[model samples]
Target: MTEEREPGFQEPIEYEEECENCEVRVAAICQSCGMPMNSAADYGGGNEDNNCCVHCCCEDGSLKSYEEVHQSMISLFMKTRGLDKERAEQAARDYMATMPAWIGR
Candidate 1:
């Protein structure tokens, strides 16, 4: 039986070809911010092949520097969540640590 999803909800498109090898279905997500890339508009350069999101890309389609992305995330958290500078910075750092772009750094 088919299940019902809320309006505007799109099933995540798996980017990986070797689905059997993957323990979990890997959705197309922004390498920088971990945002799910549900549509072409969600990807950097409006290209589905891009690994990052539009927010994490420069006008020329290159990924932004780590510091630039870090600052943006911090500001977003501060503005949206009403978090203080220190808390926002820490939250951004923690969140970025899990993202593919910032995994090692």
Candidate 2:
């Protein structure tokens, strides 16, 4: 008897380098937290921040970076900083919303 192979079972592609999508930097993302790699590379310009980029090239066309501008604001709401989850989530949303299109910046 012959065995049949599955139709959609494909092997995953391994890359030597980190993903350049969300969280590109290894230091920015937390390990104990067990969260998915946050998308930091999508931003563009490298940063000591969330590993995303300082120059965020968002889908929408807007050239404005709030990463630094709102860094202090978000810091206050960080869960790791004794802040509530709600506060952290709110800050995350606000920061992402201000992300600008890093078109060759």
Candidate 3:
């Protein structure tokens, strides 16, 4: 059955696929938050472990809680991608909602 969408809900974004094994199958999305991870290799580069984007992990290579990850992801997307604040906020929420297993505490 087709589901109804909320008013003013934008469709999910389509991203490039230059990187391999991206979790979302989008070119430059972070596996954790499903946002763009377009920083240089030394800074948030993609890795074989789920191809998680650099920003998705801490400097020590630990994963952030879902809330923290999504918040940072939304902010980065807003500044780097010039996305609308409200839309980015919603996107962050939606992405987090889909991955409750990673959202510890």
Give the best candidate by TM-score: 1
Residue by residue across 1-105, what tens digits does model 2's lDDT show?
876534432222222236778665443321112122335443324322332333332234232354543454456557456766667767655544433221122
- Total backbone collisions for each predicted model: 0, 9, 3
Question: What residue pairs clash in candidate 2, if any at all?
Answer: 22-39, 22-40, 23-38, 23-39, 23-40, 40-52, 43-55, 43-56, 57-102
Candidate 2 runs further than 4 Å off: 1-80, 101-105
Instruction: For candidate 2, give the lDDT of residue 7.
Output: 42
What TM-score, computed on C-alpha atoms, does each candidate reach?
Answer: 0.72, 0.24, 0.45
lDDT of 3 by residue, 25-78 (tens): 444445455545444452243343333456667665566667678788689769
Local distance difference test scores for all models: 0.80, 0.38, 0.56
lDDT of 3 at 97: 58
RMSD of each: 11.4, 16.7, 9.0
Note the residue pairs that clash in candidate 3. 16-27, 17-27, 44-54
Between prediction 1 and prediction 3, the one with superior lDDT is 1
Which candidate tops lDDT?
1
Worst 10 residues of 1 by lDDT: 5-14
